[model samples]
Structure formats: C-alpha cells, structure tokens
Target chain A: MLYLSTISWLQEGPFALYRWNSLKEDLPLFFHAFLYTIGISLGALALAFVLGIFFGILSATKNKGAVFLSRIYVEFFQNTPLLIQIFFIYYGLPLINIVLPVYLIGILCVGIYHGAYIAEVVRSGIGSVPRGQSEAAASQGFSYWETMFYVVLPQAWRMMLPPLTNQLVNLIKNTSTIAIISGADIMFTANSWSSMNLNYVPAFAFAGILYFILCFPLAKWARHMEEKNKKAYSR
Target chain B: MIQMEGVNKYFGDHHVLKNISLTIEEGEKVVIIGPSGSGKSTLIRCINGLETITDGLITIQDIDVTKKEAPIRNIREKVAMVFQNFNLYAHKTILENLTLAPIKVKGIKKAEAEKTGMEYLERVGLADKAAAYPAQLSGGQQQRVAIARALNMHPEVILFDEPTSALDPEMIQEVLDVMIDLSKINITMIVVTHEMGFARTVADKVIFMDDGAIVETGTPEHFFTSTENQRAKDFLSKIIHH
Candidate 1:
C-alpha cells in the first residue's frame, strides 16, 4: 500500500515533465521508436501494395500458370500466422544462411503477411471493373496492357482506396507485434519504459495516444478521399 | 472487306457457331437478323477478332485472323465495333472516351486527338456532351457517344452488334439515325440488328443465321422478299409479321 502511493507520486507524468531534462532525454528515444514504427510499417505496406497489386493482376488473368502460382502464394502466406512467420524469417532463415539484416526481414515478414490479404482486396477491385469496359477498349484496338492500365485500373482504383487504406492501418497496428522479435519499434520502447519506470499504466497510455495520433488522421484522410472520388464518379 | 470461310466457334462443348460463312464487300452494308442465340452477333463479333473461331479462316481486309502473330491490332484499328450496351469507361468523360484509343494506341497528340474527338462528336451530334459522364447521358445519347468513339478511331469497317437492341423504342431512332448517317459516308459496315426496318433501309445484303450456321444469305430484297428457306421464311414471318 505504501509502495503504491510512492510509485504514483514518482510517476504522476505531469510532474515528470517539470524536470524537463530527464523527460527530454527519453523523448528522442521515444520519437526514434515512433519514427521507426511508422517507417517500417509504411515501407512494408508499400512493398505489399506493389507486390499485391502485381500478383493480384496475375491471379485474375487467363494464363493458367500465373493464376496457379498466385494462388499458391496467397494461400501459403494466409495460412501462416504472422508472428510465427516473422519468427521463421528472423530465426529460422539463418539456418539456411540467408543473411538479410533484421530490419529488412522484419519489413518483409510484415509485407508477406499483409500482402496476401491485400492481393485479394486488389483482385476483387480489378474484378469489379466490368468486362464490357475491357471489351470496349480492345475493340478500340488498345492492347491488353493498355486497356488494363488506362481503362480498367483507373476505374478499379477508386474502389481499391478504402480497402487498401484499411489494410495500411491494419499494417501500422500490426507493427506492435514486431516487439516480440526485438524490432526496436515503438511498442518495444513502451515496454522498456514500463520496465524502467515501474508504472505500466501511464507508459502504455502515452504510447497508445501516440499510435492514435498516427492512425486516426489516416482514417479521416482516407474517408475524405473516398468521398471525393465517389463524387467525381457520380458526376 | 471482311470474309468468314466455314468458321465454327465452340463455347465449351456447345457449338455457338457451326460452319458459318459470310463475305462483305468494300463500302457495302450488311445486316444480320435472327432470334436470340441465332449466332448473328457472334458472326459479326468474329469479324473483328473479338471472338476466336474454332475452325476456318477469318479475313479482314485480306489479312487472315487465325495466325498467332496476326496483325490483329492493326486489323482492329481498321475495323471498329459499336456494342448495343455502349460500354463507356465510366471513369472518363465523353471527350476522353473518344480520344483514349487514338491518343494511346495510335500515338496521336492530345490536341490532335481532341480535335478528332470533337469532329466525330459533331458528326454524332454529341459535341455539347464532351465533358459529361456516360452515366449522366440518356441511352440514346450514350449510344451516339459510342458511335463517335468508334468513328474517332477512323476504321474502314464498322461493326454494330445490335446497335438499337438495348434502347427504348423512343430512343432507338436517335442511335439509328447516327448509324444511317454513318452508312451515307460509304463506310463498310456489318451490322447485327433485329431492327428489320433498319435492315430494309440500310442493308445491301441480309444474312440470317439460326442454330449457328448461315441458313440464308442474299440481297435484302431477295432474302426479305423472295426467300423460301423454311427457317428463313419462318424467322422472317415471325420477326416481320409480328
């Protein structure tokens, strides 16, 4: 009971800031962690989105071999748990003497895990483009790639925005899972803060608010873009 | 000119086209008429390489379509198609629809493509709708834009797959007039239409298909007036007398 008040007294976070130097010392580490989390997650999402959209196009094509390979890729990633998949890359990959740095492996693990879901999102978006559009493009003497690039994908892109944004937010949150593998991102920083300060509640609350700051604006931005795109199409 | 020699097409095991053969001369207009699933649309579709043939050679302007490296794109550039449903790219406005092919495929400059688009739009009487979305236009207006789009490509042969088949009765004439105007320019056209009036007015020749084969082919006067092939007579009586 005595220890509780002492703990509370020391960690009344409002007062911790009064000695600006101590708080300032930790701020850079916290900011670094925050930046790393955002960078890694966004990077992973970029990679996933590229590969996802590419494979997604392949999956929807008429070529039997491309479709078969994409199916296998999607299924394999989806069936594996993301954490186990990360572990496999971080630890098990070394057994085969694959010597990628931890950061790239971390980014790739997250990308491959999310990429499967993203590929499906992209495939359905492309599928939602009416076949008549492609036929019309072809009738105009546009090659298949030209038709897809100009006619089909532009139309599909509007529908893709909401799902793709959702996947990206999911990716940012999934960065917390990286802490288990010592990724040195924001969640790991929060863990270290709680351990050092012996005040789990305030440290977690602080980190939670930081994450909210990152993701909430993205959600609002995506919603606005979706509305604008819908209005454009409606017009 | 377009020619199909004993062409057959299969969708799965079902024979969608069977021993179908046709020939269209330069500057000639031919209309194909039949009941639904009579292979009339498929016959015209095969002419433009939209549908592949299972057997026999399809020649458009004397170039064979069956070869793997067939200048299909070059051939298609020479032959344009107008679909009944008027499948416009929903994301682009009317102006972009007309110019996308010419600008992208033919390497025409933006200003040149727009000028060509506006010219065709004027021809189809859609110059005022250059900025309008397809969904904002009426069925007739949409169909006219479709014609203008095909015309902007400046093909030698124009194929219409039931051009008025999807329009309301009042809207049909607007599209048909654009088609009629197209014919007066002496562009070679092979139109698959159920509009017997259109066939009677526009066609130099009429071909009737039933169960995937050309059951009868002749000049409109002979086929529509004097033909006695039982299936042709029956199909015409049902279509005309009805």
Candidate 2:
C-alpha cells in the first residue's frame, strides 16, 4: 500500500493544466510525429485506393475466373486481423531473408488490409449503378472498358464517395496500430510521452484530438459531396 | 436492314421470345404493338444483339448477330437504340451524350462530332439544352436528346422501345413530334410502343404480338380496324381510345 496525500487528484501536482506547459517544449517533436502519421495514412490510402479499385472492378466483372480471383484476395485480407498482417510483413518477411523498413511495412500492411474493404465498397458501388447505363453505352457502340470508364465508373464514384471517406477515417485510426511496432507516428509519440512523464490521460487525450482533427474534415467533405451528387441527380 | 430467322430467346425457361421471324427493309418504319410480356421489345433487342438469342439467327445490315465472335461494337455502330427510360449518361451534358460515340467509336474528330451532335440536337429541338445534364431536362426533352444521340451515329436502323411510354401525358407530343420528323427522314426504324396514333400515321407495317409470338401482321389500318385475331382485337379495344 502507498501513502496518500491530502491533495485532490485533479488539482494535484503535474497532472493538471500546468502539465500541458511541460509538453510545450516537445511540441515540435509531436507535430513532426503528427506529420509522419499523416504521410503514412496518405501513402497507405493511395496504395489502398489503387488496389481496391482494381480488385473492385475485377470482382464486378461477369467473368467467373476474374471474379473468383478477386474474391480470394478480398476474403483473405478482410478476414485476417490488421495486427497479424502488420507483424507478418514486419517480422515474417525476414524469415525468407526479405527485409523492409518499418514505415514501408506499416504502409503495406495498412494498405492491403483496408484495400479489401475498399474493394467491397467499390464492387457494391459499381453494382449500384443502373444496368441501363451500361446498356445505353453499349448500344452507342462503346466497348466494355469504354463503357466502364466513361459512363459506369463516374456514376459509381459518386455513389462511392461516402463509404470511401468512411474507409479513410478508419484507415487514419488504424495507423495507430503501427505504434505496437515502435513506428514513429503520432500515436507512437503519445505512447513514449505517456510512459516517461506518467501522463497517460493527457497524452492519449491530445492524441485523440489530433486524430479527430485529421478525420473530421474528411467526414464533412463526404457529406458535402453526397449532398451535391443528390442535388445534381435529383429529378 | 434487319432480319431474324426463327429466333428464340429464353430467360431461364421462361421463353421471352419464340420463333421470331421478321424482316425490316431499309428505310421502312415498322411498329410493334403488344400487351406487356408479349416480347415485342425482346424481338427488337435481338436485332441489336442486346439480348442474346437462344437459337436461330439475327442479321443487321448483313452482319450476323448470333456469332459469338461477331464485333458487337461494329454491329452497334449501324444499330442504335432509344430506351423507354431515356438512358442518357447522367454525368455528361446533353452535347457530350450526343458527341461521345461519334468521337470515341467512329473516330471522328471532336470538333466534327460536336458539329454533327449540334445538328442533330437542332433536329430534336434541344440545341438550347446542350449544356444541360439529363436530370436538368424534362422527360420529353431527355427523350429528344436520346433521339439526337442515336442520330449522331448515323445508324441505318434505330430501335425505339416505348420512347413515349415514360413521358407525362402532356409531354408525349413533343417526343412524338421528334419521332415523326425522324420517320420523315426515311431512316429505318423499329418502334415498340403503345401509341397507336403514331403507328397509324408513320408505320409502313404493324406487327401485333401476344404471349411471345406474333399474333397478326398487317398495315396499321388492318391491325387497327380489321384484325381477325380475337386477342389482337381485345388488346386493341383495351388500349385504343380514339
């Protein structure tokens, strides 16, 4: 048992509002770590979007073989845990003598992990487009790919924006998982700060605020885009 | 010209089209009128290879449509379709809808395609709406743009599938006027519609179908006033008012 002081918890020594001043000197480091978080998320999101769109289109195709191939990829990634996927890349790859830096591993793991869900979003988005659109395009002598690119995908993209933005938000949060591997992202910095200063509550609270800052505008933009599309298409 | 020789189509054992043998000569306007589920639309769809035939053959402009190796895009260049819903590309402007195929498929220069597109837009009385999207236009205006989009391809045959059925009653005349003008241009057309007045005026021949088979084939006057088939007479009595 430890001896108790007479002071209240909230009003006590270093855990109060004055503790934030101690963090003022380390603000630059935290900001840089925040940049690393954003950079990693963007890099992962870009890779995920490309892979997702490709797999999504593949799954939407009428070809049995192509759809089967896409199904395998989607199911495999989506079913596995993100943490295991990170470790597999970070730790398992070296068993075969292929080593990658932690940042690259984080990007690859986060990208493919979220790419599976994005593919599902894309598949359903493309599916949601009216069949008549493709028929009309084909009737106009547009080839399969031409119809997809020029007509179908544009409409699908509009339908897909909301869900895709949700995925981006999730990707941003998921970046914190990289902390387990000691990746130098914002969450990693929060972990280090909380441990050294024993300021777990404030450090995590600030980190959560930073994540909110990153994701809030994206969610707002998705809603705005959805409203714009609804108005544009409203009869 | 379009020809279907004993064509049959099935949607998983529900025969949508049965032994559809028909010929539409170049410059001839053929109107197909029928009750719902009678396969009039499917017959026209077969000519364009939009619905694959289960058996027999369909030929449009002397190209076999039943061959799996057939160049469908090439076939479609000569055959264009106007849908009941006026399936205009919603993301594109009316001008872009008209110009896209001409530029992309026909390999016409963009400027030339735009000129051709605008000319057809003028023909449909929608030149003023070229900058507008399909959603911005009324149902009648959209149908007119659909017609212009088909015309931009310079297709030998245009298939109209209930082009006026989806329009408001007051809006029907505007689309019919465009169709009437198109008929006067001597381009071959196969129209599936409930508008008997249009058929009586513009059709070179009229075909009546029931239960996936042709019930009667005659001049519009014959089908409208003197058909011997009981089903055709019943259908006419049910649908025709004036």
Candidate 3:
C-alpha cells in the first residue's frame, strides 16, 4: 500500500522539483547551507571537546569537590532537552540584555549539551584502565598528575578514541537543531526553500543525504577504532 | 629501615590487619609466606603507603607513613614494589617504561636515565626486548621487564608481592631467577610469595601470617621445619605437599 501510494504521488503530485534543471538551480543554495552546517558543527565540536576534557578530568580526579562540581555540570546539561537549551540561549537570553549572535548561540548550546555526554565517555574511558596501572605508577614515586600524563592517559586514550568519535558524530548531526533559530544551516535551508517552491520531498531527502555524508564516515571510523581496540592488548 | 608499630587496617566492618608490629632492617631480605587472603600483601602494601592503616604507626627511615602530611612521595621514591601481574605500562615500550619514572620523578637527564634503564634491562636479561611492548612479551618476560623498571628507580627497598603467582609453571622460574639475582644486592627486600624454594634460597628472615596477624617470624630453617605456630604449620603443609 505504501509503495503504491508513493508511486501514485510521484506520478500525479506536484513533484516537478525532481526535474534536473530545477534541482540544478537549487544546488548552490543547498551547498551554501551545507558549508554553514559544517562551520557550526566544527565550532561546536571544538567547544564540546574543550569542556568535555576539562570536565572529564575533573570528574576522574580523587578530589570529592572536583568530582561533585563536574557531576552537577554533567547532570544539568544531560537531563534537560537540547531544544530547550537552544531556545533559552537564542530567544530568552535576549530578554535579559544578553543578545548573543545566532551562530554563537548555536555553538554554545549544542556544544555544552554534548559536552556532558563526552565528559561521561571520558570518565568511563579513564575508569576502564586497570587500577594496577595507577598503583604501579604511585609505587614508582610518580605524582598524581604525572601518573595521569605519563601512564594512565596514554592507555585511556586508546579506550577514549572510539567513543569520542561517536560523540563527534552526534555533535555534527545535532547542528541541525540550529535550524529552529534561523541559523541558515542545511535543515533551515531545506525547510525555507522547500516551503517556497513546494518541493518538500527532494529538499528534505537531499538534506538527509548531506547529513549522512558528514556523519557516516565518522561513525564508521568509530566502529573501526572499537574493533581495533578489542585486539589492542593481544600480541 | 622500616618499622610497623601496632598497625591495624579494616575494610569497613571487616578487619584485614590486626596489631601488626615488625621491623625490616636495611639490606635484609625478608620473605612473608601465608595462605591467600591472609593480609600478607596488605602488610607490605602498608609499608609503602599503598593501603593506609586504620590505626597505629608505620615509619620508613624515620618518615611517618600514617601522618596525613607525611612525605609519602619521598618514601615511595625509596621503596619500590613489584606486583603479581607485572603492571608495566602496556602503551609504552619496555625501555620507555624503565626510563619513565627516573626522568619524571627523579628529574634525571633523559640520556643518563636511558643509559641506566638499559643497564637494568640488561641485568634482567631483557635488554633485547627493550623495543617491545608489554603485551608482546610472555608473562615471565613482562615480569622481568617489571623488575627492570623497578630497579631503574635505584630504590633502597623493594617489595615483591607474589611476583611469580601469575606466571605459567614453565615461566615462574625465569621471573624467580631475576628476583634471586636481585637479592644479592645490598638493597632491603620484602617478598610475599608461596614459593618455599625462593624463601629458602634468598631470604635472610622469613615471616608467616594468618588471619591478619604475623603468626611466625624466623630464619628460613626455623620457618620451614621448626615453626611451632599451628597455623603456619598447616599453611606450610598445604603449600609444600602440593
């Protein structure tokens, strides 16, 4: 039934946008939005990683206060909805004289939201290293920070990479959330352009393809890393 | 060089070490033998501040181990430990593992530390495996590398915590051989092991523990044959007969 309906819609509906000449005209606008999406994703990714690593190390430390502070950051950002965060930064912040640019708002909201998830990935990565590793380092007179820098982090980095790449993929896909704020990202372009020309199917389908192009390779690489990590300790 | 006075340790409600008091003289090779879960590992672990005592005092060369403000790092620099699993940094090559602590903790020059590291690796008969990662080596080879890593620290005291228990039967002798060679030096050695042969050959003093207390302390002959403590006798019989 679904297939028959789709075929009938293709034959009888306003599907003129699928024509090559019309698509060719819309390609440049889509490409620009694609680049914009990439830009916001990269900026947000940088912010996320910085916050992630900082909070990751903070949570992993032995200090109770440090761990507690990171716990609060992780919990607050993780439990709340990302769309709500984006709305508050983009719409509500301006009410209190804190008018951030749309681009900055997109970066901060998305970055901080995913930063919580990345922080968890990092904490678990560091935790996965054998306790004996740190004990050995301590017995050799290594300071806590020195042990982390020299022994623990190097081992943990291998464990962290696959998960961290996964977080990067999530961060990229989440850049679409910026569309609601009129950030001119790929999703926004698809919405606005398709509405104007009544070409929702092609525009939305191509927008998905663009996101797949950005995200699929990263997700695939993360799976590859996870596979390699399984055999990392074996001869 | 190490003294424990009424050291007590508890894991929540369960007591793990009780009224432990002993002294390890400089350059003396002391071997601790006991059944599993007898707190022998915990005792030596306390000497280096790895497991904090619940009550009482432990001092290494006049440095108080139980004091919160004590110089634990300084004590660790002088006291090295060899673990049963030979916890070499799996990410680093053998040579890198050997040189890491000296260069980082002692602030030694890289070249000088590498030279000393190579010498210790050669001493442990693993100079050829310097470029190898820990996972690339057999259990015996890895433990030998661990010993080499510890010796590179030039510690005044070395603690061996069941160092050969993790190796295959064919591999235990190789690691024990490295440790036997280590005993000839003038550094204080505290060993916890089930190997009666190693204790007989290398130990100047032997101690037996059970139920979180030192049950017997004596020369190897006294510990192996003449131990009057019933718990030590039972432990000896079980391990020796098998």
Candidate 4:
C-alpha cells in the first residue's frame, strides 16, 4: 500500500515528469522535427555513399599514392570523434570565417564521418571477391576499370548490400548529433521541450521510439540480405 | 608464335622460374608437365603477361611482352587462357560470361558476340546451360563454359593451365574431351596438366620441368618411352603407377 501510493505520487504530484497534457500540446512540433531528421538523414546518406565509393575504389586500387590518400581520409575521419567533428564545423569554423548553415554542417560532418566506415565496408566487399575473378577478366583482355565495372563490382555489390544497409541505419541514428548544434532535429526538439517542462522521461522515450521507427525496418532488411547471401551460391 | 629467352621469375627471395628459354610455333600443340610449384603454370602465365618475368624477353607475334609500354592488351586479345578453377564470373549467366570479353575487348557487335558465344557453347555441348549461372552448374560444366568463353574470343592461341585438375574423377573426361576436340582446330595450344594420357594423345611437344628448370623437351613418344633423364623417369613411374 505504501509503495503504490509513492508510485502514484511520483506519477501525478509536483515531482511528476511525464504530463500527458503537455506532451499532447507539443506533438506537432515533434512531428515537424521528425520530418527534418528524415530530410537530413537522406541528404547525408547520399553524400556518404558517393564519398564511400570514391574512396573505396581508391583504396582498393594497386597504385601506392591513391591507396595512401584513401588511407589518410579513412584514418583521420574514423579516429576522431563525431562530436568533435560537429563542434569543429559548428563552432571552430566560425572563428576562421568559414561559417556554414546549421543543416549543412549537420549533413557534411555526419556524412563525411560515416563515409569512412562505409569505405571500409566497400573495400572489404571488393576484397571478398576471389582474385581469380579479376585475373580471368584480365586474361580476356579487359582493362582494370573494365574488369571492375563488368565483373568485380557486380559481384562485390551483392556482398556489400547488407553491410551498406546497416550503415544507412547507423547514418539515420547519427543525425541526432545535429541536436547539439541546436539544429531543429528530433533530439533537439526533445531536449528543448523536456528542459522547459522537466518531462525528460517521456521526451526521451518518444524520441527513442521515433528513431526505432526509422531504423528497425532497415536493420531487419540487412539481416534478411545477409541470410540470402549465405545461400546465394548453394544449389 | 610465342618465344621466351632466358626467362627468370622470383617471388621475393624464392626463385620460381630459373633461366629458361623456349619457343612455341604457330598452331603447335605443346603440353607442359611437372610437379606442383615447378613453374609450369608460371611459364604459361608469363607468356600472356599474367605473371611478370623478373628478367626475360617474351614476344608473341612480334609484340614484346617484356616492355611495359607495349600493347599487352593486344597480346591478351590474341591469347586466351582456361584456368584450373574455371574462374567463371559467378554473377553472370554462362552466355553473358562468354560474350563479355568479345564485346568489351574486341569491340565485337553485341549481336555478333552472342552469335559466336552460342556457337562456342554448342561446341562445348553446353548450349542448354547458357542461361545458367556458374554456381548452378557442375565443376565439369563450368569448365566447359570457360572453354567456350575462351573460344568466343577467337584467339590465335589458348593456354590451358591445369583445366581438368580441379574436376571430380568422373568429370575430368568431359573437360578433356572438349580440349581434345579443341586441339583438332588450327590454333596454338599450350597446356599445363598432369593428364599424361591427354598429353600422349594430343601434344606435339611435351616439356618436363623440375625445380624451376626445363629437365627435358621431347615428343610424347620420346618422353613416354625413351626419356633417359633420371628425374623424368622417376616422375613418369610415380605418375603412371598412381
């Protein structure tokens, strides 16, 4: 009887954290932020894919200089924290008179950060293909680029799809970093709305649910692709 | 014709091919036999510029293979190779695999390449399997498609690097049958294999290698019945008995 009364007090008293009336009033704002998050994620994902493929091919090539350049790009982006990258783009660049719009900064930093990981995924995908596939292409007089386009990339694409989809899921989650810069994404809206009303529990819980809505299907699809790839060559 | 003069290859500190000189005439059928890692495959691979020779001069139809600036693709255009593992493009249908090189490298019309591809598939008796993926076929069927792929290129020479070595015992005969039929055509053939019977029946010249060196070069009769080299004799006995 005592524990039940305490629970009710926490739920409805002055110390209450999740007020249904307040949350209902802010639902439209949260919905708008959700849309903004989707826009940022889609833009960032496109940029990441472009950079990933370019750097991945550079790393996979036999040329020493190209591989070296790609390694530098991947290492620098992968080693540093995404927060620092975001802060640098948002705050540090202003001192140097290179101010970017908040949305642009969010897309650029998250896109470039995830681009390094996607490049690795792409490189390993290409590496997973047998050496004989390229050699056989060479024996038939296909040039290096021709072999990649016609034979190697088509095969590597199959192996890459699952990991690439997973990367996209990660990309969507990482867009939350836009909140720290006060970009009007879902996390930003949740942080601001919760601070005003001290409703942190319901605020964060709903934010989590929104993110899950975006990512769960992608993660599930990746698992399906991985399973199918395992059976690809089997009778 | 293909020519090699004092070819030597090294993998880091290990010597793979010693000072070797050989000549292959046009339309000649030459079979190379040796123990594994004896540089027989390396020798043929060097001819088509697949493996770089450390120090040597190799020429195919007057194209210098040793020169970096030379048109190696031109040489590859003239010479096709069938690998031990078949190495078919796994993502492509068998017919697409056959037509890819001819259309891409030779700049043959897609229609004409498809026509040639179907003809070669028919030659290898795999016309029915043309729509199948490499993974969907048996080891022997894939090798036949690989052979048909080489034939689609209309190459002046075909290099067979242990084409039947990776097949099941029951399937070896199918791949060999295609190669024997191939030898009847007027194209230069350089094969590296352990199939002594195929060598005896089809090879115009047989070269034996041991320890990165050409131990003997002779006709099949001389190699099979009258070779005086102790190493060749020993190798023959072990292979024949096995």
> What is the TM-score of each predicted model, taking all chains together?
0.94, 0.89, 0.88, 0.90
Tens-digit lDDT track of model 3 for A1-235: 7656766666645664254346578799999999999999998999998898789989999899999999999999999999999998787888999998888899999899999999998889889999999999999988787888788877898888987888888898898998998999999999998788777777888899999999998888888887887777544
lDDT of 4 by residue, B137-238 (tens): 999999999999998999999999999999999999999999999999999999999999999999999999998999999999999999999999999999
| Candidate 1 C-alpha lDDT tens digits along B1-242 | 68888888999998999987777899999888887998888888888788888899888778998778898889888888999899988999999999999888888899999998999999988899999999999999999999999988888988999888899999999998988888898699889988888888889998888898888888888987899899988888888677
Each candidate's chain A: what TM-score? Answer: 0.87, 0.92, 0.88, 0.89
Residue B9's C-alpha lDDT in candidate 2?
85
**lDDT (10s digit) by residue, model 1, range A1-235:** 7546766656555444333445456788879889999888878988898889878888989999999998998999999789998888788878998877766876898888888888888889989999999999998888877887899989998899999889888888888888888778888887887687654565567678878988899999999999899788546
Candidate 2 local lDDT, B1-242, one digit each (tens) = 78888888899989988788888899999999999989988888888788888998888777898999998988899889999999999899999999988899999999999999999999988899888889889999999999999999999889999999899999999999999999988799999999989999999999999999987889988888888899998998989653
Higher-scoring candidate on DockQ, 1 or 4: 1
User: What is the DockQ for all candidates, taken in turn?
Assistant: 0.75, 0.51, 0.52, 0.52
> Candidate 2 regions off by >4 Å?
A1-22, A64-68, A193-205, A233-235, B221-230
Top candidate on TM-score is: 1
Reference-based lDDT, each prediction: 0.86, 0.90, 0.90, 0.92
**CAPRI-style quality class for the chain A–B interface of candidate 2:** medium
Q: In terms of DockQ, which candidate is stronger, 2 or 4?
A: 4
For candidate 4, give the lDDT of residue A62. Answer: 89
